[model samples]
Target: MSISRLSSALVASLLLFGAACGDDTVGTSPNNMTTPPGVDVPIPMGSKLQHTGQCAGQVNCQVDVTFNSSAPLQVRVIDGNGAPVVGAAVRYELSVGLAVGTSLNAASAQTNSDGVAQVEIRAGQATGAAEVIVSLPGDTSVAPIKFVAGVQPKDSASYSVTFEHAGTASLRDIKVFLYKAEDSCDAIREDIARERDDDASTNPVLTAEYTANGVASVDGTLPLVVFPGLSNGQSFNVAAQAMSRDDGEVELAFGCTDSNPPIENGNSVNVIVRLEDHLPRLKGSFDVTHTFSITDAICDPQPNGGYAGVLPSGVCLAIDLIGRLATDPASFILGEGSGDTGIIGLIVDFLPDDGILGTLKGAIESFLGNSLIQNLGRDALNEFFATWIENNAPDWVKGGIDITADIYESLQEFRVNGIIRIEREPDPTLDTETNTVVGLLNADQDGNRPGKQVWEDIIVYWTGDCASSAPAACRERTFSATDLGATSSVVEGSFTGTVVPLTGEGETGFGLIINEHTLALNYGVLILGIIEQVVLPSIFGPTVTSLEAALNELLLLVLPGGTTGCQGFADFMVDNIGSSVETIARNLCESLLESASDGIREFLTENLTISGEDNFLLATPTGTPCKLVEPEAYTGAWIGKPLPYIDGLGTDSMLCEWDVKIRISQDTIIETDGTFSGNRTGF
Candidate 1:
C-alpha cells in the first residue's frame, strides 16, 4: 500500500481505537443530510420521471433523483380509505440528462416504523410510465405528520454553566459578574487598572452587564446570555465568568472584547469548569475545558480590520485563551526597505467605550505587545509602516471628462461649415480692413513692447439660445487650479479692429478659442502624487498591516481558545499577506450586500452557485434584479460583477460576486450600475 494510504489508515486507527497510528482523523459518519418526511410514493420502477416518461426508446441512459427532505422523512404506502398497502412491488423509470426530473438507479426503500418508502430508477429503462400508486391512508391533519428538519434558533442561544463552591466549605456572598463578552477585555483591563465608577466614553462599544449573586453558599444559578444588544443584524453570544474567589483557580468565564467574540455558534467544544479548594491540585492539575461544534455557517472572518485601534473591553477578553490569542496575535509586515515601511499611526480606541481602557489600558498594551496605554492615554502603539506601496495608474480625470471619445474627437469641429469661398454674401459690398501692412513698425523707435498690436476691437454676433452644458454644481466652478490666467497679460484678440469678443450664441463651455496664444501643459504631478501616495494606499492597503495585526489580536481575544480541538484557529487569527486580505475583502463585500440578496438560492438549494444562477438572481431593495435607472447598460464599477473571468466552465457563465470571483460559470451575474444619487449635508 502507498505510504499516504498507510499513514491515513494508521491515523484513523489511532484516533478511532486509541491504537498506534498516524495523524489522520478517523471518519465514520458523513455530513448530515436533511431527513425528508415519511412518504409512501411507490415507484413503478423509479421516481425519476426524466427518461421514464417517453424518451428512452432509442438510447441508453440512467436517471438519478435526489430526494431532499427536511427530517424524519419517511414514507409508507397505504390503500384507499386509510389502509396500509403491504408488500407493494413498485417499479420506476429515471432520466439522466436534464434538471426537469432526475434518473433513478437502484433498489427502492420499504416502509418501516414510520410508514415510509424510497425507490430508485436505473438507466437503459423503457419509455413506459411506471409508479407505485398507494391509496390515501387518512387525513394527515389530525395526527399532523410532518417532514420537519428541526432547524431554528436564529435568535436563541444554548449554554450550560456550572459553579463549584469551596469543595466541602462554604462562604457567603458569592458574586459573579457577567459582562458582555463583547467588551469584557477592556472592562477587565480598565477595572483592573483604574479606580473609578464614573467615566464618560464615546464609542457605543459592544458590552453586556449581568450580575448573579454569590454561588459561594453552596449554590447559585449561572446566567445564560441571549443578546448583547447592537441590532443592525449584528449578533453575539459568548460568556465570561470570573475566576474562583480563590486563586485564579476558580476560573471565571470572561472576555477581552478586543478580539472577535467566539463565533455566534462556533463553540464546537464545551467548557467544563470544575471548582476545587485544594491548593496544588486546583492550581496546576485541573483543566477547565469545553467541547463544541457548529453548523457550517457562522464561521466567517471579522470585518474592517477588526479592532485595529480599538480598546477591547475586559468582558471581550475574559472568554478563553484562544479568544485571547484571537484578540492578541503576532503580526508583522514585510518591508521593502529601511524607513520605506509605511507608518500606521494609532487612530486610538477602535471602540472607545467609557474611555476607560484606563482600567483595561495596561492589559491592551500588554495585549498588543505595543506600547500603547488605554483610557489614561493610548493603548499599544506598535509602529507598523505600510508595506503597501502605491503604484500609479493613468490619471483619472474627473469633472465630466468621460464625455465619450466619439464626442471628444468630434469636438475638434473647426468651423467646417461652408468653405472659405466667400460667396461675397459676407458683405462683399462693405469695405474690409486688411492688415494693409499698417506698416511693420520700426523696432528702433516705436519700442512699444515690440509685440504685435491690434489697435481695434471686433464684435462677432449670433442668434438663438444654446443648450446648457453645466452639471448642477457648476456655479462655484472657478478654475480648479491655483489661478486662472484668463485676464492675464496673455495675448488678447478681437474680431473687430485689433481685438475680438467671443460673441454669438453658442454652448457656454463648448470649445476653446485662441489665436497667436500659447498653451501651458498641466502635468499635474501633485495630483498624481496624491493618487499614488494617498489614494491607492488609503483605499487598498491603508494601515493594512497594523490593522491586520490589531485584528489578529481581536480574533484571538474573541474566537474560542485551545480548549477547543480545532486547529488553524490561530491561522485564522492573523490575516496573512496575500489571499488573506482578498478573502476578508470578499467576505466584507458579501456582508455589505447581504441585505440585497442574502444568497436566497444558495439557502434554498444547499449548493453554492456560479454567479448565483438566473433563477437565483438576488433582488435589490425594491425586489428587482438590479433594474437600470435608465434602461442603460450596467456601467457601474461594482465591487464584483458577473464577468468572463473563466472559460471552459460551460455556457450560462456569469460573473460571480460581480467582477471578483470569475471562475464559476452559471450564466448569472450580480450587477450594479454604481449610479447613486444621495443628499449629504457637508460639501
Candidate 2:
C-alpha cells in the first residue's frame, strides 16, 4: 500500500480507539443541521433530519483531529407520521481550507431500515479548520448540515529540560533553544547570537528560560518546552547556556544535546544538559601587567665601612695593591733599572718581582673568564700596558680625583608588560562523553593560537646625594638590550607552554604548564653597556685619578735628593702606571660584565619560569573558565624561587617574583547573526 494510504489507516485505528474510549465528542461540530426559511421544497409533514451517534453535536468543536484520521458522522431521517423513511439517501461534502486528500468515504449513503445514514469525514496532512456538510440528496427542504474539524500533525510531544552543574557557583538563569536535527551546531550558535542581540525577527522553534536559586533544577524539572507542527519520528537539537555570578563577575557555561532522539506520540521526554567550560567561550587576548623585584644580598651594606661584598675578591685584591703603591712609593720599588733609571723603570722592574703583575693579571683573568676574553686577548692586553708606559706618561699625573663613597648604594628597577592570546587548536583533542578537552599551547611569534609574548625594560637610579635639592646630582640611567642604548623602552620576548584540562575534588578546570623559557633579551650586551657607560665612568675613573695624585704626593715626601726632579719622575711613572691599570681594569670588567650577564640571564630565566602546575579551579573567578566581554580584567600573582647569587657569593638571595594583573579585550567583533555591525560588547 502507498505511504499515504497506510497513514490514513493508522489514523483511522486511532480514531476507533478514541471512540471506544468514549472520546467520540472530539472534533465534533457544535450545532446540528436545520432547514433554511428561503428554501422552497415539498416535504412530507412532520419529517425531520438530525445528527446521531457518538459524533453528534460535534460541529466546529475546538479539538485536535490527527492527520489522515476519519471522524464518523451518522444521521437519521423520519417520515411525517414519525415512521422510518427507509431507502432515503444522504450526501456529504467538505468545505475548502481542509488539507488536500480530506474527503468523505462515500458521497452518498442510503438509510437503513432504522432510518439511519452514515459517512466518514477524513482529514489530511495539513493543519487547519474545515467544515463537513451533510444533506439529503435532491431535497432542498433540509439545509446543509455543517461539522467542523481541525487537522493537526500526529505524534507531537513536549520536552522538559533539566540542567546540571557540577561546580559550586549558583546558577542565575538558563536559556534553552531548539533547532532542526539537520542544523549544525554553528547554525544554532548563530540563532543564539540573534536572540542575544534582541533581534525580533529571528525566532527559534522552541525557547525557554529557567531561573534558579542556588541550584540548577527546581523539583527535578523546569518549564515544558513545546514545539508545534512536529510529527512522529522527527528529531531536533537542543542548545542551552547557564549563567552565574560570583563576586560581581559573570560566568557562562554551555551544553548541547547532539543527535537527539526522535519524538514519540504523546511522550514528554526529559532531556539532561550538563554545563561545561567550552574553549570557544574562553578564546581572547589578555593584557598582563607584572611588577617584580630582583635583589642581591651582595649589594647590601656590611658592618665594615669597606664594601668587601660588593666587588669580587680578585678585584678587591688588585685595588688594595694599587692603593698601597699610591700611599708608599718607596716600598713598591725593588731596585734601579739600566735603560731608564726613572721611576717608570723602577716600577716596571718591581711589578714582576712583587707579583703585582701576576696578581692583577690573575684577577683580570678570573673576572673575564675564558669565554668572554676570547676577543680581548691577554697578549694584546700586556702589549698595550707596556706600550702605554713608553708614551704619554706625564698627562695622568696632573689630574685630581675623588671617589664616591656610596657608589654601591643604588636601586635597580625592572618593568615588564605582555599580551596573552588564547585560541582554538586546529585539531583539538576532545572527549565528548566526558566533555573534556586537551588544549595545546606554544610560543608562536606570529601571534597565532595560544601563546604569551612579553616586553621588558630596566632602569638604575643612584641613591647617593638624594638629600641634595638638585635632582641632576642624583644620577639615573635606563638600559635597553635591544639597541644597547640608554632608553626607557621594552624589548620583546616569548614564553612556551601547554594547558591541559584538570579534574579533581569534584571540580574541573585547566592547568597551565609553562616550559623553561629563555628570554630573547641580550643580557650580556646589556650589562656590558651599563658597566662601560655608567660603572667605569662614575666609579672607576675617580678611583684611578685618586691613586695617581696620592702616589705623586708620596714620591715628593720619600725621595732623598733633588726632590723636584724625583717628584717629576715619580709623577710620570704614577700617571702612566695608574692610567694603564685603569684601562686594563675597564677592559677586563667589560668582559666580566658580559660573562656575568649570561649567568644573570640564566638565573633570571629559571626563577622567572613558573614552576609546577598552576592549578586553577574551573568555577572560581580566577579560573580559566570565563566569559569574554569587550574588555575583561583579571589580577593574580606569580611567585618564583629565590634569586641566586653570582658565583655563590652570598648566603641568601631575595625571591624573584611578579605581581600579575591582566586586562582582556577584543578589537574585532564577529556577529554570528549575519548583521555584522561590529558593535557587539560581549560573547
Q: What is the lDDT of residue 320 in candidate 1?
A: 14
Clash pairs, model 2 backbone? 28-58, 28-59, 29-58, 29-59, 29-60, 30-59, 45-80
Give the runs in model 1 whose Cα sits over 4 Å from its true position: 1-155, 163-187, 192-683
Best by TM-score: 2
Where in model 2 is the C-alpha error above 4 Å? 1-156, 166-171, 184-232, 243-251, 280-289, 294-296, 299-413, 417-438, 443-456, 468-477, 483-492, 498-513, 521-683
lDDT of 2 by residue, 1-683 (tens): 99999999887776555433133323221122233322323445566665554434432222235678876666666777766566666777776363566777767666665665566667788755555667776475654455545456666543444555533333445667666677766676665556444447775533432221222332222222223344567666777665543312334456677577876774544566666543323233444333333243223324443343433332222222332232222222211112112122222222333365656556543433433232233233333333322342232211222112222222223333344444433223555665555445554567543543444334454442244465753555544334333221344434444444445454333444434333443332333344434443343343322223333333333222433434333344334354434444443333323333343233322322223222111111133322112112322321110100011100112112222211111221111100000111111
RMSD of each: 42.7, 23.4
Q: Global lDDT for candidate 1?
A: 0.23
